[model samples]
Target: MSSSQFQLIKEARLKNNCPECYSNDSLELTIKQKLSETQFYKSITNEIVSDINCLNCELQIFPVRWTDDIEQVVNYHKRGLNLKTKSVALKPISWGIITFFTVIIIATILFATGVLVL
Candidate 1:
């Protein structure tokens, strides 16, 4: 089975106050991108997500509770982010599987045409 995970792309400390704790200089913002992995290949996807947490309150701050200023700062940081390009990388096992299938197909064709006998 394939698995998907979020890999950290960027982390920044924000000066905004946490709505829950009302503390400044404790808010942290983090951005992450999705990665999918399987036995055959690993892929980086374009899906991106962000999260905010307060160090003082040790709590996660959801977007519903975000103040206007906090939202603006988050947007600014997002605009400046340099995200990774999406790509896929095949494993050695996958290459072996492809080679095996190719060889089998070619041999079958040759036998049908009488080029390969017995």
Candidate 2:
């Protein structure tokens, strides 16, 4: 059976106050990605999720729960993270598709020219 996997893309701790406990230097931000694959199927990926956790209050704070002050702090910290990325890699399924088309075109041409005996 085919299975799916998850990966951590970016994780940064934001030193902001917890809305519940009112403590500083207790918030953490995590960004994750999910990759999925199956038998005879194309691989799918590039799913992302962002979450914020508070150490002081042990609560998961959603974006709607953030106040103005929290938003500013979060944005400032996000700007500093500054991660660089490169080009994406094609999956095995893509290569297989390209090869299949090439072979079909070649076979068609050869048969039309009487070069292929089939």
Candidate 3:
């Protein structure tokens, strides 16, 4: 069974005040992708989660704690953020199926032309 994993998609540090610790330039925002494979199948699903942490107090900050000034600053930075997303890659099982079909067709062709012994 494949276990679910959280991969860091994007990480950015903001020079903003931490509401919890009241520290300046200690906030960090991170976006993570949680990937999980379906049981008894090769299908995989991905979900996104965002987190804000304060390095000074080691506290997790919430959006509700953001002041108006902080909101404006976050919005300004948000406009500059270029979030690039990538499509999921094809699994090895799909290539294996294609190869199996190709080999079967080749074997059939060889047998029909008497090129394959027995």
Candidate 4:
């Protein structure tokens, strides 16, 4: 079974004020990248997500609550982020399974051609 998770890519402390609490220097921005994992392989996907929170208020600030200043800061931080590339890596078990199947197929072919004897 494959499982999907979001891994933290970046966290930035912004000087923008929280619209709800009206507190300055309490806003934080977080970025995450999607990761998929299974017994056979692990992969990083291109999907990215972000969240904003207020440390002083201990509340999550959704986009709907963002002020213009907060939005601008978030946009700046997002533009500066260095995101990871999407990639897949196979596990040892997956390699072993592939090798086992390849050997079986080769053996079968050889036997059909009368090149392999029992």
Best by lDDT: 1
lDDT of 4 by residue, 26-105 (tens): 98899999999999999999998999989999999999988888888888888888888889999999999999999999
lDDT of 3 by residue, 1-52 (tens): 6667667767778888788878988888886666665433343344566678
- Per-prediction TM-score, please? 0.89, 0.64, 0.54, 0.87
Better of 1 and 4 by TM-score: 1
Which ranges of candidate 3 are over 4 A from the true structure? 2-4, 33-48, 98-118
* lDDT of each residue in 24-116, candidate 1, tens digit only: 999999999999999999999999999999999999999999999999999999898888899999999999999999999999999999999
Q: Which ranges in model 2 have alpha carbons more than 4 Å from their true place? A: 1-6, 33-48, 82-97
Best by TM-score: 1
Give candidate 1 regions above 4 Å deviation.
none
Residue lDDT tens for model 2, 1-118: 5677655666777776788888888888876566665644534455556778998889999999998887887666555553434224566777798899999999999999999988
Residue pairs in clash, model 1: none
Q: Sorted on TM-score, highest at the top, how do the candidates line up? A: 1, 4, 2, 3
Total clashing residue pairs per candidate? 0, 0, 0, 0
Q: Listing every candidate in turn, what is its Cα RMSD in Å to the true structure after a full C-alpha superposition? A: 1.5, 3.8, 5.3, 1.7
| lDDT of model 1 at position 90 | 100
- Sort all candidates by lDDT, best to worst: 1, 4, 2, 3
lDDT to native, each model: 0.95, 0.73, 0.72, 0.92
* Of candidates 2 and 1, the better by lDDT: 1
